[model samples]
Target: MKEEKMRFPLSPKANPQAVITGEHYRFTVLTPKLIRLEYAENGMFEDRATQTVLNRAFPVPAFRKLENDVSLEIITEAFHLHYLKKGPFSPNALFIEVKSNFTNYKNRGRRLADLANEF
Candidate 1:
């Protein structure tokens, strides 16, 4: 098979101010309510937009990150995030608490734990 020229090439959005990275984990704050979490077993994270992610050039949202020896915390206007800096993601390892006037939403890492294993 012959190779064809690509119509649309991928463009990278590298916003260092919006990212928090560790040895094997990377968390990017895309918006006040949207965050991108990535894990690389080989310690290499993707920088360019992929087929699933077309546009990643979002304005950096307001957030504060706190880190301890055992855990990491990120606070934003819309939510609070807690992550255990252990091996991989677990129900007890990561959680998000949504801040709202109406209701409180607590999300455990059931699906996030699976994503870690795929790496």
Candidate 2:
């Protein structure tokens, strides 16, 4: 049997409601299954890094607009993502919340070992 490889396009159309563009970064909702986050040091045309985070692995996500367009809710099969835009107090903060059926437990043994492996 041949193993199929999944491919995600680097550029995709942004959802008008959830899209935000800044001088150094561009954030957009590409599709119900994925969201694209891009950053450029100089500008979008130079020295850029792009990454697409999966929102729904199987079923498509449902997007919900929150109060006064301050927050957005992305409901997926695997997880729920809550995105909060920067506010008056936090002018440069981007907050994200991931709700899933998993607990994040820090491994003390792996902490030092992982740091050493980096070198």
lDDT, candidate 2, equals 0.41
Which ten residues in a row are the worst by lDDT in model 2? 86-95
Q: Model 2: residues >4 Å from true position, as ranges?
A: 1-11, 45-96, 106-119
lDDT (C-alpha) at residue 18 in model 2: 59
TM-score of each: 0.72, 0.35
Per-structure clash totals for the candidates: 0, 0
The TM-score of candidate 1 is 0.72
Best by TM-score: 1
Winning candidate number (lDDT): 1
In candidate 1, what are the lDDT values of residues 29-109, reduced to their tens digit?
A: 888888888877887987877676667776778999999866788899998888777766555677787887464543553
Model 1 residue 20 CA deviation in Å: 0.1
Per-residue lDDT for 73 in model 1? Answer: 83
**Cα lDDT listed for each candidate:** 0.76, 0.41
Write the residue-wise lDDT of candidate 2 on 1-119 in tens digits: 99999976443343356554554555455455455555556545321333533232223235553333344344544334443433211212332344443557521223322333333
Model 1 clashing residue pairs (backbone): none
